[model samples]
Target: MGKEILDLAEWKSTLTAFAKERDWEKFHTPKNLATALSVEASELLELFQWLTAEESTLLPQKNKDEKLRKNIEREMADVLVYLLRLATVLEVDLSKALQEKMAENAKKYPADKVKGLSKKYDQY
Candidate 1:
């Protein structure tokens, strides 16, 4: 098991320290971070590229492959780390942004009207 991070601030601080230690902070511009984020997200998505729906859902589960699960976990962590770094660089409050977006989503896709529906909010 790995050490637990208590909150976003801790994760940011830890990642910042890591970058600083490696003298990599200079390359962590918003654009670069966003690009890295996209690449990492793509890598994560690639992990399930050929699996059927059930196989995708059961990733590293049906087969009980620790290496597969670890690969997925590492790719996911890379994506998140870059996202957090980008948010930090842009001075964005992710928590507040998520709250606002969720509120907008609830209004746009009210459960009473869109229950069990898969259409886009604008479509319905």
Candidate 2:
């Protein structure tokens, strides 16, 4: 393997091993993992706190700042890690859950009715 392609199973196993080695499974409850995920998401959002809508959209390329990019990447990794850990702890199939949720959303916001419209499903 060139760089050890990291699929969902590999990521889960890696995370599981890390947690097990540190004996942190006791504290990795669903609620705690969810809270940590939220906190990491907030930290990611803070990176664009002072930027305007347009500025925020172009943050990754327009700024050309490696440090800011790295910070955002790190925060994103944190969020993903927590999400994966939470799914593992809860025995939730992440891929299946994503597919099911996308199907639900498609029904809620059918393309024919919601195309080019930025309205919530209820509003539509």
Candidate 3:
């Protein structure tokens, strides 16, 4: 079957259905999902644990090892899945939340002030 283009709602519904089918919803509370999200994020970070800054930046293209690339991809997907699950459980409107967050960040880190700086917003 052809893959359907999935929006946030559809992705949330898919994850919800998968949880329901496996009777996993009982364990999918916001707190649990949040913890899972953090764990998955750590797993993703682990993929680059020993790499230098430049190596990490070049990982996606410079690494010719298909298996390593696949591992990175899978870890990234795990992080994203747990994040989406957490957001869904919290009843967050992801798109709206992202827009609001971007607006806040834009104010905090105005281009003129932060163009080449990697410092925190408070430092700007």
For each predicted model, how many residue pairs clash, with residues at least 3 apart or on different chains?
A: 0, 0, 0
Q: Which ten contiguous residues of candidate 3 have the minimum total lDDT?
A: 57-66
Q: Write candidate 3's Cα lDDT for 1-124 as tens digits.
A: 9997648888889998999999999999988998888888898888889888987777678546677789889988888788788888888988999999999999999999999999999885
Deviation in angstroms for 82 in model 3?
1.3
- C-alpha RMSD for every candidate: 2.7, 2.8, 3.1
1-124, model 2: which lDDT tens digit per residue? 4786549988999999999999999999999999999999999999989888987667769457778888999999999999999999999999999999999998999999999999999895
> How well does each candidate superpose onto the true structure, as a TM-score?
0.90, 0.90, 0.90
- Write out the backbone clash pairs for model 3: none
Count of backbone collisions in candidate 3: 0
Q: Candidates 1 and 2: which is better by lDDT?
A: 2
Report, for every candidate in turn, its global Cα lDDT versus the true structure: 0.89, 0.92, 0.86
Displacement of residue 123 (Cα, Å) in model 1 is: 1.0
Model 1, CA-based lDDT: 0.89
Weakest ten-residue segment in model 2 by summed lDDT = 55-64
The total of clashing pairs for model 1 equals 0
